[model samples]
Target chain A: MVNERSGRAALAELVTSRSVLVCVGSGGVGKTSMAAALALEAARRGRRTIVVTIDPARRLADALGLERLGGEPLPITELIAASSGLRSGSSPTGSLHALMLDAKATFDDLVTRHATDRAQAERILANRFYHSISTTLSGTQEYMAAEKLGELHTSGRFDLIVVDTPPTRQALDFLDAPGQLARFLDHPAYRLMTGSGSAVSRVAGAAGKRLLRAAARLVGSVALDDAVEFFRAFEGLEAGFLTRALAVRDLLVSAQTGFVVVTSARPEPIAEAGYFLDRLAAQDIPVDAIVANRMTPRFTRLTAAELRRIAAAQDAGGDQVLRTGLAELIELTAAAEAEERALAPLHTGRAIPFQQGPFQQGPFQQVPFQQVPFQQVPLLDHDVHDLGGLEQLRQSAFDD
Target chain B: MDPSAFFTGTAVHLVAGKGGVGRTTLTAALGIAAARVGLEVLLVEIEGRGGLAAGFGHRALGYEETVLAERIRGRSLRAEDCLVEYLGGHGLGLLTRPMVDSGLVEVITRGTPGIKDILLLGKIRQLEQARCADVILVDTPASGHALSFLRSPQGLLDAIDNGPVNDQAVAALHLLQDAARCQVLLVTTPEETPVSETIETAYRLEDEIGLHLGPVLVNGVLARTPHRDTDTGHSNPDDPDPDDPDAEGRWVRELGIDRDLAHAVQQAAVFGRRRRDAQRRQVLRLTEQLPLPRLEVAHRPDGIDDLGALAEELLGGLRAW
Candidate 1:
């Protein structure tokens, strides 16, 4: 069931050939670490690479040897130089950079860039409604992530860009963001809100006007006026925003981009990965590989009956210590086997009956996409928190 | 040591943790545990695809509560639905259809940043005040958004001065601050990243949000016997244990085990030992860093099918706590 060649070759191709690699998975599944390791591989192969991470733990920063990452890309090759043990000339063309996504700051920058004038930008920026939406709106962060990717891709400074997306279904929002923004910009209600006349005056019916007044009263007229002003100021910038949003959409589905779905050997995350594969396949975005992280090592194939016989014999021999020890060993092997069973749907074409119900199948059961590599990273004894740990991860992921 | 008080002492329990830390499953297990104590429990999941209901072996949950078990009811909440409900409560019931269908609610929710979260909390507050259930278990968003979700009420209170929305925020904030009304239950695994995030989240919740926290749940900890690994003696035939004479020979000859099998089992044992040791260190670190009670849930080999067993284990943990 282990296809080392395909897995290694696919990973190599991802870093070497693809311009953009977006790693998506449920939270706490080591998606961030996997992304960083893949970016490190690209850097080591002499391609300039940058990894854009979202809400990574502090230890992951320490792992990458960066003191801190903010909105701007910071060169990290020098930071990891001492720990990585690289001589000066080895892969000299290779370079690595990293940045943490600041969604609010990115949105503000977009507003400043697209606005017709500084006064218009300031008018919108100073509005409380604008401030709130930019920081707290559901799709803003995801749209900003897509915008940042588009920015970096246009910069053409790096050969490879790896994005560690936000967790769960929100990661899918990052894909829909561009189109959602474009559609909203074109929505008639948005135009009505930003219409030149007073919003109440523009409503044709008494009921429409009454509901608008009620909404205004519920949120308070002061706050509602601020929203009106913000949208009015935002009207002229729509063309630029629309053009950029469409460009981002184009970049996401282009041939240079690839999606790598990361998951663990757990049922929930595997189900999530399957959902992601189905979504991406529906959109025709190519998935480069599926990384199954933190997999327990399958050490033995011995059944519980065989192990119980050994333990019972040891019990008869009066070596109770050996008996208990063998029992614990049996439990460990059984657990490893369970992990393998959990991961089977990702590899085997057939669906097996779970204790609860039939196993949920993903795009892995379908053809062509079944050719996508399944790279399994064994659960290491120690937690991964530094460049050394990342190097170990890279070795396991890239080396056959 | 009685866990009945833990169930009915608070009106609402917000179960929160990083994604994949089993927050939803733990919420379901807590509801089951509460129901076992003869309390009617309402499991509330926000912006999820019926994960809480699925935990109880049911289909997706809607806005209306459905009986999931003997005494447990579950429902799912979305921001838009909460807004519609909020509007209806404000005597705008007739306006809901046109407003929702016309994208006005979406516009209002999008225009205001924290309003969506505030609306959800406001609904939860209403549920608590109306005594809809004996206990309400809210499975909140993952840790990344949990802070913002909890902070939204206060954020709205600061942003809006005099309005119905402001009044709602104040009420939600009051509920969150009232120790008898609500408490957050944090869940984490005995791993470096999760433990670290849990500790940070605990302090932030206490200091920033001024919210009361319940016991920290250390989920998926490896359960081990209190026996030393070396006491099993060496399985290496090339280098027999001097402490236990002919231990290897006895294992292969008397125990009917081959040397290769013994060696493989020995490696497996070593791996298990190391994994357990690492987790122990993490648990110890969590104990030393945070000043809260810790509840340990053992790893389940059977996965989702073990929720009932986990609920029983949680009740045992609460009893000990």
Candidate 2:
């Protein structure tokens, strides 16, 4: 829970009420875990849900107790069965589903499904250049995330979809994926290359052919022929590609979409989160929640002056028992104070929420980000590799 | 026993790790360490927001190589510039800049799948072969991107059989896969997730990319619970509150502080010790599971404030190993 005004109700609404929840943040703040936990929590709430991860090097499959993840979603029935010591049918509202995005396979599926003719599809699919480059393509992962979301949404298979975006270096790249894909399809150079479809374009490209003939004399004939053939193969599908890319872009900013930003309280990560928030605002994407993971734990309650006076009394009176105990307290107090100092910068744009009492500590004070509701998850005692660990994280997320 | 021997002949020294694990700091420190050994070092940052320059106490560096120290220089590599240089190599010098200006460069770099990484690696490979420095320290992208960046050469080679891009990929591969010329050092924290990823990345670099692996540099390790190596530690570390009846009575009566306060302090110390103990267990797991040599740098409570001091500390650690 972030605070009294907003708490787990916000998370509950994001998971159950919304059609799609996209987790966005800088890299390495446990975004995968948060996404999985949200999906599982939604499933427990009796909503059919699936969480998709676009991180190429992810352990989401391992975290969900599956050996591996592929393009299709695998229902997590056996793991839930193992957890409650019951059979696979014990799951409520079916079960949660998970899959890692296979960029190459998804693109292939798109081509096969959308091509005008089987032969046209086969030519595009079997092109040597397409076969080699699709898997390790740079921007295809982000492009496919949007495409897959649109696919799953139209299929009506899952009521709620939780998606995890890749940790992109440039903050705008992920949001700009659909536009970039559409732009690529509509590029002048690309259209010039693939304009072999219409008779008008074919006759118009005669000048281009003459220019290419001159260049072919300068370069190798075989290489230019292969290049021309690769582009011509996709001529039949160019219009479909542009229209689908534009629709995917529109689906990203649709009313059903919501974004959740996850980050840590560290200085660098906070700045990164600010950058992400700024970009989202520019793009007009609604941010639902902010999750701050692995915040430093606090254990001290008394003020510094009070602790010093107690220490002075222990030293003067020479009681070893009280002295040793107070000494331990002092050391721990210092560590807690240092942690507070580390998080001080993030406390900007908000008043210090601390209030000192005689002996008892008050409720936990929170520093919300830009007045937006946010939840904080403490670092778990162990790494989460199985359903049991994920349950632990879920409990912490709701409790903390 | 020779610390410099690990880096003696390696021309391309790459520093990589999970994001937010201080890869940039370690790369700068390693570059300075190599430079101190009378080796000319160039610290290269590709697509980064000048983390290298910030570390060296300078304003953000640009495309041009800027000297930051006595024996070290820094360069921020961008795809557009690297592509221009690459095209100019093929007798297209006149059309390169205009192509970049008309926004055709981004479409080629971002739209054409593996061209961006291939171009970046091609640039790095050129510097390596040119012997621009005795040791070229590259601060690479975070783990997943770094792996793909290294894989671009082969990806392009497979996609285009024998074009100019294929030639560039072949050149990048020769520099990356030559174990005697290139070595990779991975940095990680003593946490579970980062360590797990570090282990996986190291395997991929060796098995897939075939780059030689160096010692795993563990950062942010803490000191023993109460007793630190420095003087600003607890007054008494081993013994908690000493048990003297007279002292206890005087403090309880005179200070007016409740027994709850003492208990709170005791709880805090226990938590501190427990964290340190957990970290030790994590470190042990890395050592037992990984075959690579490991070097640990303790957590600086204050911080590594200056790059010069950090370089000195890193040099000491390297020599002691």
**TM-scores of the candidates, chain A only:** 0.87, 0.78
lDDT of each candidate versus the true structure: 0.78, 0.69
* Per-residue lDDT of candidate 2, residues B166-206 (tens digit): 77778888888998888888998877667878888988888
TM-score against truth, every candidate: 0.91, 0.83
lDDT of 2 by residue, A1-400 (tens): 2342464667877876788888877776777888888887777767788999988876587567566898998788655454443224434664678989888889899889887889978887877656644666566777777678778888999988989877665434646765676576656545555553456656657655554443333223443454456567766676765566567667667877778888765545555665566567667676678787765444457755567676875546564444545655665455446545544533343322221111112221232344566676766645566788787777677644
Weakest 10 consecutive residues, lDDT, candidate 2 chain A?
Answer: A355-364
Per-residue alpha-carbon lDDT of model 1 for A53-131, expressed as tens digits? Answer: 7663443464575557778998876534533655455576778898888888998998898888999989988988888
For model 1 chain B, the run of ten residues with the poorest summed lDDT: B233-242
TM-score of the candidate numbered 2? 0.83
Residue pairs in collision within model 1: A63-A386
| Residue B85 C-alpha lDDT in model 1 | 74
Q: After superposition, how far is residue A213 of candidate 2 from its true place, in Å?
A: 7.6
